[model samples]
Target: MAAGNDTRITEPTAAAGRRGVLLGAASLLAGAALPFRRARAQDAKVNMRISWWGSDDRHQRTLKMIKLWESRNPGATMAAQYGGLIGYQDKLSTEFAGRNAPDVMQIADNRESLIASGRLMLLDPYIASGQLNLADANKSVLETVKVGGKLYSIPWGLAGGCFFFDTKVFADTGVELPGLGWNWDDFAAAARKISKAAPKGMYGSADIWAPAGTRAFYPFEFFLRGRGKTAFTEAGKLNFGANELTEWLSFWDGLRREGAVPPAEVTALENGYETSPIIAGRSAMYPINSSIASSLQGLSKNKLVVGTIPSGLGSKALPATQYGAFINTSMQVYVNAATKFPKQSIEFVNMITNDPEFAKIQLMSRGVSLSSKMAALVTPDIAPIEQSMVQMVQYVQEHATPLYVPWPKAGSQIQDLMQRTHQQVAFGQASVAQAVTRFIDEAGQIME
Candidate 1:
């Protein structure tokens, strides 16, 4: 959708104005150091600050794990910082610039800038010293935390993107459940048929009209992969041709225009996995990270099933890895570049990553456990969300191809542009040709 046109969609309203201010103030105090006065005075203790973004359940579980860590290792105290996702990047960047960043911070997808700016410590020496073992982690994840042959992070979990559908809903519409090797055309045809047959209030698919990296982007990425083209070169240049992207955008636009997908007005209020259309049983299919399926299942009364995202009509399955949790040298207990306690920090990191019990507690909160040994420890005791995640990971590893390491820089922006183009085309603000032309021109500038 055009930038201004988005106003018509009724963006998710901000939290009540006064309440938001109070929460913001509370967050500032909680996120900063004043509240940790007692812990700070223990000069001989190892005091670390760890920050991450998550739901209340994650925060509670992680804090419990911190308490466990402290009990097992006396004289160790960790200050916790947690927040919602919206402004996490800004908060972390500010902390880094102020040189008061937490000893352990959760790294987001923007690792390239963190590494390039020399803000992250190189973890190679620690890894070589047997501090952590990531040999069994997904290769794409390993590469995400590496720069110029040096290890700067360790993967925390495994993740993959897949299609989620309500089988009963599809069956009710007389549509066949998608099977292996169905391509985009097959999906489109099925969507059209399903829409025609579905109950009046239902849609065949949730409209994910946003560009790449937004939940809608994965299907397009899979399409590109099926064609054997990477989105970018190793040196970080845009790689797809105009025609290829335009055609893909057009397909998505067509779905929205034909009402095969939910309207943008409805989709605007939904985030990935939480989109109202899917949760409300108004849509039959959604594409999202496999890990999110459990949460979706809990929120809905319907029976949700997982399957491969459709490729081209009649094309074989072409799977891609979703995001993985990798260690961020800047966020974890990195040995300060000038610290006298590098060994201690390294040991702490090793304990966190390689310890089976610790890894199980971390679980899907960080993503999926990176070590094969740690992964084996995943039991029913882990949160149901995480247990489902483990099953999803195993399924993906069995069915999907390993994804190439994503380009470290400009990746988010590239994804943003793709989503924007998709939205514009879907809203009829721009034709597929116009959207692609603008996207390529903008992407070329940003990637350079």
Candidate 2:
């Protein structure tokens, strides 16, 4: 979609200059503001550098979207730097430290840190000016990305946790595919049954909750939240106690001992979506981020279907509409607060997020549209997998609790500690009790 008619590269207004002076370069710089002082004074073209981490599919589509934006607005040029998620944060952090960060970026794990350090440009002004249309945004979803009462980022799409299963594998093993109401106990039992029935080399599931791998804390966080607690609070403290952590570790250990999941050797080799055991046919089900359903479907030969994660069973009281999973931003887009052309950057993000045609091209590659208007506009054109993601998200929104806060600033460090602690237990380097105790101690130190 085209942005506003104000496409000209005009001089900063006298008031804008005064506001910039009031904001102070150092303050802006701390927020990772664009260091446009390095640019030659005579340069007129409004060029912006945008960065994100993603697969080739996402890279190509984002470039195409950028091209579309440029075509609609003359005199604006957007250059992109894209790569995988690993090291993306370090790269962005170094750039920000050097005052050479991109004008726009997709911030994930580093979000809380960036916001806490004043590194992200507050989108409040643009939202107030109606430059970035958030009226269609889910208020609760929008609120999750806010830091200290100001919106720092805008989510790309909506997604929740989903168990993406291979129907063919379950059929072959004579195991029934799990339904929506299945509990953790049922999940483990089905896994064992399927593992016994399958070919000798294949297991029923991957150690998706494997601590040494990607988003290792997701399942643990899910478990905690399912039990009516959270891993961390809005105050950024570790919310669950040591005893709870022990139970989480012990449960995974049980799954491992029962041969319900792939062996450590197989899980240890996991790199990402491409190297996932599901793609390699080493397992029947994979816990996906719910947004990547289309990518998983593209990679697997079996008929892939999306289902809910295990519920609380009858052990704990649940809300009348409760489901175990929660909706979260798959990723978020934000503009540099210090960009010379904040209006242009915000407009670009607005089009990418709220424009109907852009949504169709994206096709929930990120996740389902969080905007009601965009979701409705693109509904007819999305792929079946994308449709399933939207449907599953709708189900969760109506039936599940939403994560109340963005991961804390220390989230990545906490996740690392959790992964290593679990890996120690998984590899027999430490007892579950030892691992849990160590994690609690280390985590307290990190959060402190």
Candidate 3:
């Protein structure tokens, strides 16, 4: 249980962590023929600046991990720089654009843009020197982060979109909890049933497609992928047209009309996890990024359990896997392309990802470990909630379609447009047809 603690992340033996890092991977930096400028000498002191955006929990744990790293290797310090996610992207964008980004960073939504900016470093050299061994990484996931046959980022872990439900609410309502392979039809029916039988103030589900259009789009992408197509292609085109988009918007509209989801007023307040309807006990189930379930569970009084996200189970000749959710947030952790200490930066990330004791400290807070070794290391005694996350990660890693395309700048604009368009439909401000047309047309404009 000590190693499995999620909230109070106690550092395991500092020596064990250090030893694992020192001896875990073979080979040293073979040469200095890399980077825009000269690489640091092998024995030179390394003081790295690592930045990431997360809640207090992530910030504190990352600091502790940094301390452990410093303690493991004397005189090599890491200065911490982090904040809430609100403007982190813009700040990082400004930093990267200025070529003053941190040595090590955890990138997410802005990954494609940053990578495309010709500022991020390719990790092929480190991998070639065996300083960063990816033999343990999930092959499908590693492929997603590669751009033009070169690596820039390493996933913190792997996760996907999934449904985390309050088992107590289902039990009290006498509605059966869904097993694996549940489809959208099954999801809506159970939701309507739960809404009808539940207490006066509560609904069956949160408006998963809430204020953020991209929030809605995650599951929509999964839903589309289940039908053997994707929302966007590698060429940056809207792969699904009005007919498909209308169906997606209208499905949510029907749920809102049936009161199966919380009203718009309630959903608008759900911009942060602390304000989630599940945490507030106003809803029974939510479609969430699978990795956050443990953190969210810590906030809830209910026995929360995760299940596969609703997919196109009714579709004949489904893809290799019926599960529609693909990996999310594994597109994290990168070395600034211009870092003078490329070797040190790669070592730090390599340790955080592949080290055994570090795996125990980190657990699946980011995502399930994509490394075969790290995955095996943490799963032995992870917290029950974390175990559920691992199971979901495993399910998606095995069955869900592999989804990664370096998004252009227009991607964010399109996602923001989705938020407004979805809100219009949810608030009864726009017809599904109108909203769909606007979204498609605006997305087209954004692309052009």
Local accuracy of candidate 3 as per-residue lDDT tens digits, 213-237:
1276677778777667767777888
Which structure among the candidates has the greatest TM-score? 2
For model 2, the local distance difference test gives: 0.77
Error of 1 at 438 (Å): 1.0
TM-score of each: 0.78, 0.86, 0.85
Candidates 2 and 3, the one with greater TM-score:
2
**Model 3 stretches astray by more than 4 angstroms:** 1-44, 211-214, 315-323, 402-404
- State the C-alpha lDDT per candidate: 0.64, 0.77, 0.77
Question: For model 2, how does the per-residue alpha-carbon lDDT over 355-425 read when each residue is reduced to its tens digit?
Answer: 97788778677887878899899888877777767877777667666555557888988988877886788
lDDT of 3: 0.77
Report clashes for each candidate as comma-separated counts.
19, 2, 3
TM-score of 3: 0.85
